[model samples]
Target: MARSEEQFKKIRDQRYEEISNAALKIFARKGFAGTKISDITSSINLSHGLLYHYFKSKEEIYVALITNVLELFSQAVEEAESNNGTPYGKLRWLTELTFKGDFDVALDRHMLLMEAMQADFLSQDTKEQIIDQYTTALKGIGRIIAEGQQTGLFRDGDEMELAAYYISLSQGITLWNAKGLYPIRVSADMVLDPLMKRG
Candidate 1:
């Protein structure tokens, strides 16, 4: 019997995600320039034609992965901004959300973002899009920090700079977690400490 349209759609979505996961694994480790279509295909035991059916080229896969990661980051920041609570509470929520996942998978996603930021070979448009996303995230976080400062719950400083520090601290911890050199579960306090107001 022939598969229904819904079944075909489900299979397509599954294959697309599989290709994405396989591509992400390679892109995270090899960087876009170093990675090849064959690398991603073989990693998931997928054929070249099948992978192409989902993505046009290796660059397309890398771009898709980066775009998806940035979108998630943007959405999280937006959520924090819209959250009805104290700025400190919002920051805590964001911090917790960041660490609330598989450490290895989070590390991979973070690594890909880091590499993409430094990848000069990428199209100017793609680079600009990344910068735009970062700017948006920083602005959202900065708004939260600004509110916290108004309430005397956060330190006084440039809110944007504080936002950068906030994001950097979280990303640093992600990289550290993957090292396995130190077995410690990072808590939200560790991330919010620098921003939190003190007597």
Candidate 2:
């Protein structure tokens, strides 16, 4: 039986996703310096040849993962901006959405971003691109916080600072979630506490 072009395309996309997922986990855990192409392939029980078919090199995979995550982050911010809700409500919704996933997956993604920012092997162009996306997301988040402040819903503070704090809080919670020794479960409300207005 002949596989249709659409079917082939679907398979190709799936393979790319699989490679990305495996690479993301490795890159997050070990950082670029410690991660090897074989590490990603072995983690997924894939052959080096098969993995290489999807990605040319480990650096390519790293760049792809970072680009994909930043793009998703931008999309999420855009969606929140357009969603029917107050700024504070949108922030709450986003916070809940961030944590509403497999703990390890979420943690890996946060850790990946952290490591990527500090990685020195990435080209200057790639670093600048990342900074651009990050700054855009930060500005979008700041706008939301600023809007909330105007509505008397968020506390008075620098919007950009508050937005940075919001992201840091989410990342902190993600890291803490991976610590099995802790019995604490951080909530969206807890993360948003810094921004919420009080009497």
Candidate topping TM-score: 1
For residues 1-199, write the lDDT of model 2, one tens digit per residue: 9999999999999988888988888888888989988888788788999887888888899889989989988988877777888997888888877887888988887888877777789888888888899889988889999999999999999999999999988888777878877845667788999888999
Q: Rate the local accuracy (lDDT) of all candidates.
A: 0.89, 0.86
Task: Evaluate model 2: give its lDDT.
Answer: 0.86
The C-alpha stretches of model 2 lying farther than 4 A from their native spots are: none
How many clashes in candidate 2?
0
Estimated TM-score for each candidate = 0.96, 0.94
Q: Which numbered prediction scores highest in lDDT against the true structure?
A: 1
lDDT per residue (tens digit) for residues 48-87 in model 1: 9988888887878888898998899889999998999889
What number of backbone clashes does candidate 1 have, counting pairs of residues 3 or more apart or in separate chains?
A: 0
Residue 69 displacement (Å), model 2: 1.0
Clashing pairs in 2: none
